[model samples]
Target chain A: MNRFKKGHISVAVVCAVLGFMISLQFRISMEQKASLPYQRLEELSSRLLDVERERDKLQEKLSALEEAAEKGEANSLSDQKASEILRQRAGLVAMEGPGVIVLIDDSRLKSKAGDNQNLYIIHDDDLLRVVNELRAAGAEVISINGQRIIATSEIRCAGPTLSVNNVRSAPPYEIHAIGDAATLENALKMRGGVMETLAVWGIQLEIQASENVEVPAYKGTTQYQYAKPAGGGAS
Target chain B: MISAVCGLIIGLVLGAFCPLIIPVAYSKLFSVALLACLDSVFGGYRSVLEDKFDNTIFISGFFTNALLAAFLVYVGDHLSIDLYYVALLTFGFRIFQNLAIIRRYFLKKH
Candidate 1:
C-alpha cells in the first residue's frame, strides 16, 4: 500500500509540472498574439525607408535647380522666389545657423522614497513644453530626435516609448533649433521656466549654444487637397 | 489517477494565477522541456504498470530528460540548426510507444 502511494504521488507531481507548463505556454502565446503588431511595424519601417530614398532624390533635384538659378541659367527671379516660398512652407530646406541644442534625458538617479517612478523619465509633455518655449524664443526651424518639426507634426507617447512624428524615440532627446543661440538658451533657463520645472521632476536637461546647428528637412509628405489659394489666382 | 488529476488541476490554477512571465527568447526551451516531461511521464506510467518502476530513476530521468532536451534546443539555436524537431520527433514517438504499451496492459487486464 505504501509503495502504491509513493508511485501515485510521483505520477501526480509529474502531471502537475506538465499542467503548469501547458498553461504557461498558453499564456505566453496569448500575450504574443496581443503584441503581434511588431510585424506591422516591420512593414511600415520598410515603407518609410522607401519614402526616405525618394525624398533624397527630390532634394537633390531641388538643389540642382537652385544652383542653376544662382548661375543665371534658364531660371527667372520670380520662379526662384516662388520655389523658395514653397520650400519653406513644405519644410524642405535644411536650416543652419547659430542656435541651441537642448538635450533632455531620463534621470540617471534611481527613484528613492517615492512610489511615483515616472518622475525620473522624460514624458511627451516635457518635450512639447520645451519645443513651445523654443518657438516662443523665435526658433525658425526645429528638429527633435532627428525628426523635423512641421506644422502637422505630432508628439505623443506610445507604450514605454515616445513617438515624435510617428517614429519611436527613447530618452536623451536631442532638440536642435536654428535661431539665436543665446536667446533660446535663456528662454529655456529663465526663472520658473521649462528647465526648472523639468529639474523638479528629476529629468536631466542640458542646453548648449552652437555657432552652427543643422535641422534636417521634414521627410513626410505634405498634401493640400482641400485648401487652395483663396480667390483662385497665385499671388 | 485521481491524485494525478487533482495535482494537474492545482498546477493549472497556479499557472493561471502566477504573474511570472517567461521571456520570448526562452519560449523554445520551455516547449522542448514540456515535451520531454510529457515523454518522461508516459515512460514512468508504463514502468509502473510493468512493476519495474524505481522512484530514484523516475525522478532523475524526469529532470535529466527535460534539461537535455532544452540543451539540445539551445545548442541548435546557437549552431543555426533545427535540432528541436529531432528532439520533438524522437520524444513524441517514444510517448506514443509508451501509450501503446499502457493500452495493451489495460486490455490484457480487462
Candidate 2:
C-alpha cells in the first residue's frame, strides 16, 4: 500500500505538470499572432499598385512599338498600351472604407414555415447582391464573418450556410468593415440595389454602424504568381 | 471532404470560436456539447486520435474549450468584458476535466 501510494502521487504530479505545459502551449498557439503590423497590408497593397503601373508602362510601350511598326512609324508602342488598358484593374489595392456590418440573422426574426405571406429565409444571392452593391457603392473595406473582401473574395452558398471567402459563416453574419458607414449604407440601400432587393424579398437587414471595427486578420495568405493581370492599359 | 459532415463541421468551426457566455459551468458544457456533436459528425475523429480517452472523456477537448472561449469573447462585447485570455480557460478546465475523466473511467469499471 505504501509503494502504491508513492506511485500514485508521483503519477498525479506528472499529470499535473503535463497539464500545465499543455495549458501554456495552448495559450501560445492561439495568441494573437503578433498582429502582422497594420502598415504591412498598406505597404503590400502599394507594391501591388506599383507592379500594376509598371506593367501598364510596359504595355503602353509594347502597344506603341506594335502600332508604329504597323504604320511603319517611329512610335510603335501605342497598340500595346491599348491592349493593356483592356486589362482594366489588377491586384488587391482596390478597396473601400470604414463601413457598416449589417447582420441579418434568425435571432429575434420570426419566420412562419407554412405561412405564404410571411416567409423570411435569407438566401445566397441576397448576400451576393449586397456585397455587389457595396463594391459598386465604393465600400473601402468589407467582410462577412470576419473574412475580408479582397478583390477576388468569393461569397457563395454552401447549403443553408453562406461562405464568405470560402470560410463557412452563419446567421447573425457579422460584416466587418472600415469605411464611411453613411455612404456605404446608402450604396446598399440605394433604389434597386442589394438592400432594396432584400427588402422586396422580405429579408431583414440589421445594420450596425461602427467607427473602429477590427476585421479579423485574414486566415489564409493569398498567392498570385502566374495570373498577373495583362499589362495594365485600360484603367 | 469530411469537414462537410452534417452542418456540424461549420457548427464546430463556429462553435470553436463561440464566445464564452453564462456561467463558466454552463459555458463549458455548451462547448462540450457542440464539440460532441461535431465529433459525431466527424465519426469520432477527435476521440479516435487519442490513445484511449480514459484521460479525455470528450473528443476535441481543446476545441470545446476554445468554443467556450469564443462564446465568451463575443459575449464580452455585450457585457463590456474582455475575455480573450484563452490561457485562463485552458488552465481552469484542466483540473475539473481530469477529475471528471478519472471518475468516469473508475466509476464505470468499479
Candidate 3:
C-alpha cells in the first residue's frame, strides 16, 4: 500500500510540473502577441489617421466660421485678415501663382576618363544650395518632391537616398517655388550659378518658368512647445 | 490517476495566479524545457506501466532533462545556430515512442 501511494505521489508531482509549464508558455505567448512591434505600429497609424481626419474637419469648420464672421462684423474683418496672413506665413495655406520648377536628376551616363562616379549622383547639399538660392531670390513658398519646405523642415542624406522633411526622395527631385518666375529662374541659371555647378558634376538640371504653380500646405503639425508671443499672454 | 489529475488542476490554478514574468529573450529556453519535461513525463508513464518505475530516476530525470534542454538552447543561441530544433525532434520522438509503449501495455492488459 505504501509503495502504491509513493508511486502515485511521484506521478502527481510530475503532472503538476507539466501543467505549470504549459500554462506559463501560453501566458508568455499571449504577452508577446500583445507587445509585437508591427501591432503597435498598426495601432499608432490608425490613431494618426483619425487625428488627421479630425484636423481636416476642424480646418473646414474654421474656414466656414471665418467666412460667416467676415459677412457679419466689419470689426472682425481685420482679425480674420490678420489670421489669414499668419497662416500664409506659417505655410498652412496652399499657394498658387507664377513660379519656377527646377528638375534635377542623377546622371545616367557612366563616368568618362578620370571622372569620379560619386559626383554623378545628386546630393542633399546640392538641393540645399538650390533652395537657398531660390529663397534668396524672394521665393515665397518652396517644395521639394511634394514635401513643403517649412522653417523646421530638414533635408539630409539617408544612405543612398535623400530625406526631405524626413520623407525619402530619390533622384529626379522636382523643386517648385511660388514667386516671381523670372527672378527665381535667373537665380538658378545665372553664370557660375546652381545650374553650372550641377552640369560640371554631370548632374542633369532643367529649369522651367510656369504661369501657375501650386505649392501644397505643410502637412506636418506646427505646434510650438517653447516659443510663445513676445509678451507671453497668448496672442 | 485521480491524484495526478488533481495535481495538474492545482498547478494550472497556481500558474494562472502567479505574477512571475519570463523575459522575451528566454522564451526559446522555456519552450525547450517544456518539451524536455513532457518527454520525461511520458517516459515515466511508460516505465510505470512496465512495472519498472523508479521514483528517484523519474524525479532526477524530470529536472535534469529540463535544465539540459534549456542549456542546449542557450549554447545554440551563443553559437548562432538553431540546436533547439534537434533537441525538440529528439525529445518529441521519445515522447511519442513512450506514449506508444504505454498505450500497448494498457491495450494488452485489457
Q: Which candidate wins on TM-score? A: 3
User: Using alpha carbons, what is the TM-score of model 3?
Assistant: 0.51
Q: TM-score of predicted model 1? A: 0.47
Q: How many residue pairs in model 1 have overlapping backbones?
A: 0
Cα displacement (Å) at residue A69, model 2: 34
lDDT of 1 by residue, B34-104 (tens): 89988988898899899998887887898899999999899999999998899989999999999999999
Chain A, model 1: TM:
0.63
What does candidate 2's lDDT look like per residue over A1-235, in tens digits? Answer: 9954553443343333333333333333354243466568889999999999999999999997787677865444556765554332322333344668787754244556665532466667777777777767676566787776766778787877888768887776777656678887888777887666667555678777777665554455567778877787944
Worst 10 residues of 2 chain A by lDDT: A86-95
- Looking at model 2, residue A189 earns an lDDT score of 72
Per-candidate DockQ versus the true complex? 0.47, 0.02, 0.52
Question: For model 3, which pairs clash?
Answer: none
What is the alpha-carbon interface RMSD for each candidate? 1.3, 14.8, 1.2
Backbone clashes, candidate 2: 32
lDDT (CA) for every model shown? 0.89, 0.56, 0.89
